[model samples]
Target chain A: MSLSKQHELHTRRYGRNVGVGLLLVGVIAIVFGLTVVKVTRGDYETPATTTVQE
Target chain B: MTDTSFNSQTGTYQTEATFGDYFALLKPRVMTLVVFTAFVGLLAAPTPVHPFIGFCAILFIAIGGGASGALNMWWDADIDAVMKRTQRRPIPAGKVTGDEAFAIGMALSAFSVVFLGLATNWFAAGLLAFTIFFYVVVYTMWLKRWTPQNIVIGGAAGAFPPMIGWAVATGGVSVESVLMFCLTFMWTPPHFWALALFMRKDYDNADVPMLTVTHGRRATRVHILVYTILLAILAVAAGFTSIGGPIYLSVAVVLNVLFLRGAWQIWRRDEDMSEADNFLTERKFFKLSLLYLFAHFGAILVEAGLDKLGWGLWA
Candidate 1:
């Protein structure tokens, strides 16, 4: 194979791999961010009242 | 300069740079040790880190370690090209340029530190930054050529990962974490000196001023024996800490005995012995040193697991 052709092949493969890796990282980051936000915000709580039982 | 080569047969220019070459610049073997030790530190900490946070911490720590490796390779390209053991490294072998390695290293160093701070805390990030600076600037650029004690001080850079790991968990340092760091720091001299005994010619040809090259084989052996004795004491004493228990104690005791025996053998060798015979013992000791480290850290991990299961000796 010609040198330029080999270089082109390698560049393409590297680009593809990097693209996939970045995509995965992006998804994980979004999920992690959301989880952090959710945990920090928490949820609404109701006041507790005492009850009498027979 | 671009990493390009003229292919006369193909009558064209091809880029010599590859993913593997870039990855090789990271020194994956060293990164593995950094990652493993850092993980053990996180697990052994009294505080429990969120699983995702721990994953991010380790990832960034590994990146920081890789950054230091790249930067070290960048600065040491000249000496690396001369040393037989390091001649095939990316920059030295013409697979990557020193400039490229430096750029990658700086970029990763920034990325890892910033993201780690955001993911965990500033303390761990700061420690990571210091580790990188110590390795690249202090060790590679300054101490390596100047002193025979290069490994002794430079080993601190490799030692900081566990402390960073512990900081990631507790957002601070402790005696336990420092002990873990000490384990690796103390192990470095004997380990590298053993290799130096067998490969003295490499350092001599490279003019790197390694202990074996500067102090002679006999002195290097004595130094190894002394450091090994100190390391054994520290390793056994570490077993009684919060991070350690019966399992870790057992592992530490057995490993230290064997390690001491190996060091003793190296120390007892006659100056008149055949070079080949001396090389064999040095090589054996060097190989055992690798196992000695991994087993110690692995034992720490087991102790952490046992503590979680409520089977810890102290618990």
Candidate 2:
């Protein structure tokens, strides 16, 4: 293959791979975000600072 | 071992690994567990750490965990390359250089330990340093390649985060902290051996002396059953401590029953039968196993919350 053709091929491959990776990441983030929302349900308080004392 | 695509061609398709590739070398999933357990340790302590300082301490410890993972990847790239599960790792897949991985790991190690010591206390820093050493030297370098008992002894690295967290808060270890350590430690063998039972080929190909390879699958099954019994005892004991309450006890009771039943079923399996048929059961246990640790520590936090409101059982 010609130099320009090889370069084009590499660019196309890289773009495709990056697109797939980003899609996977996006899906994961969405699922994770929804799960956190469901679990916390806006009832999230900062962790308490005091230890239990008798 | 240059490939034909690179060396044979005048115009080669040579690619260099990027910065993100190096970061990917760290086992982030494992790091999450370290962070959660450490947070529990910090929260459960008798003494309270300043919120800002505690956050920073746990952050440094997590970075320390990532550093250990990077170093492990660097060292184990050879074996990792051969194993199907680890073949896509940055170093083995030609996405990161071994030297680059080593440098990142070492730099992070120094930064994490020193800053942790300054931010929290020397005891926490010392524990972090030893954890990195144990994982790198004892587990990755020495035990993993040499023995079937690798995960058992090496499990200590994963178990130490809670102790370190406790030290960060209390400046010393306590029964509660040790129980947390024991819980993770005992849980490791069974968790990993299940993976080994399924992924036997990976260990065999790598020539790693995993229990499945060194001992037969039957032996591994029996060991899992035995360890599950021991782990159950340790886990249930934690429910009776100051950290435990009705919520924790309830969770523990349900978790143990399910876990013990899973083990019992596994022990009952004949070597001739395909694990594939009952793989769902084992996979369910694995999923629950993750929740098991998280829920236990989460319950500890709940107990702490209750104590603050004067409703804690221990109180």
Candidate 3:
């Protein structure tokens, strides 16, 4: 292959690498984000309030 | 019929290796240190990360370190072939092509940084990205061929892993992170110079301008001693911080004293002596250098444990 063609191929390969990397990151992020949202929400109710004599 | 033709033909076959061959290209020993130190950084941070995020951060950092090694091997193939220590490395030995190594490195580098950023935070991911770039582009491609100071500046790339780990948890830099960086940065010159002193012939044959090659063995000896003093000071100082405690202080004191003594032995030697005498000193110091960093980082983990137990001396 010509040097330019070789360079082009490598560049394309690098792009593919980046794409895979992004996909992995996206998968991780979705799971993490969902967990964070759930944790922060009012899904777990506060303990029932107890009255004390003044 | 000519040597050039034979060389070109061999180059064509350099990519023929199986899975194990590529695995060897990652420089596993260095990766181990990177992973350990980065893990320590993550654990030592004031803020806590979800366990899963923490694990992913460390995994990405290890991959980033491996990526740097792969890229370094890709760029340094010529010198690697000439050096006895590196001659059997995948690229140098024709087990992998430069293109293949480059591809693997670039791929891993991207994967490590981007995923780490997403799984944890962008700050850590950005640091990983820069570390890969600095090691490959700045250190390997530009500096290695051009200057004797390559390792000194390039050392920052290696030092950044722990800092990246710190960022993963805290999402920013702090005094503790800087201290961690200083420990590795200061440790590097002496660690590498000792090896250079012993492997002067390799550098010379490869025409790489290591300190020993450019300034003579005496200068390299003095340089090692100087860096060792600096490293000792930094190591002990680290023991006084929030990250430090009785365990780390004790570990640092013992390791630093032994390291200084080793450096003194290396410095005391005359260059005109036989290889049996001189090489022995360099070899011992080089081995000690590896143990030195391992112990120092291990001490940091100990300190973190003490802190968690509410029994830290420094705290």
Quality of candidate 3 docking, DockQ: 0.05
Candidate 2 residues B1-315, lDDT tens each?
A: 332233221122335554456568778889899999999889888787766667778888998999999999989988887899998887777656678789989988998898788666798899999999999999999999999999999999999999999999988888888888899999999888888876758999999999989988889889989999999888887888887878888888888888889888777876555455756656666777888889888888788778767788764
Residue A32 miss distance in model 1 (angstroms)? 5.1
lDDT of 3 by residue, A4-45 (tens): 545554553564466567767976785676467446754356
**In candidate 2, which residue ranges exceed 4 Å CA deviation?**
A1-54, B1-14, B275-278
lDDT of 3: 0.84
Compare candidates 2 and 3 on DockQ and give the better one. Answer: 3
Candidate 1 lDDT, B6-109, residue by residue in tens? 64422345466767788888899999999999999999888898787788789899999999999999888888878899988887777677788999999889
- Model 3 stretches astray by more than 4 angstroms: A1-54, B1-15
For every model shown, the clashing-pair count is 0, 0, 0
Q: Write the per-residue lDDT of candidate 3 for residues B1-315, one digit (tens) a residue.
A: 211212362353443455567777789989998999999999988887777668777878998899899989988888888899998898877867788899999888988887787677788898999999998899989988788898899899889988999999999999999999999998898989888887768989999989888888888889889989988998898888888888898999999999999999889887665276758878988899899898888888888877887777787
Q: How accurate is candidate 1 locally (lDDT)?
A: 0.87
Best by lDDT: 1
Query: For all the predictions, what are the DockQ values?
Result: 0.12, 0.03, 0.05
Candidate 2 lDDT at B263 equals 82
Worst 10 residues of 2 chain B by lDDT: B3-12
**All candidates' lDDT scores?**
0.87, 0.82, 0.84
The candidate 1 chain A region of ten consecutive residues with least summed lDDT is A37-46
Which runs of model 1 end up more than 4 angstroms from their true locations? Answer: A1-54, B1-15, B271-274
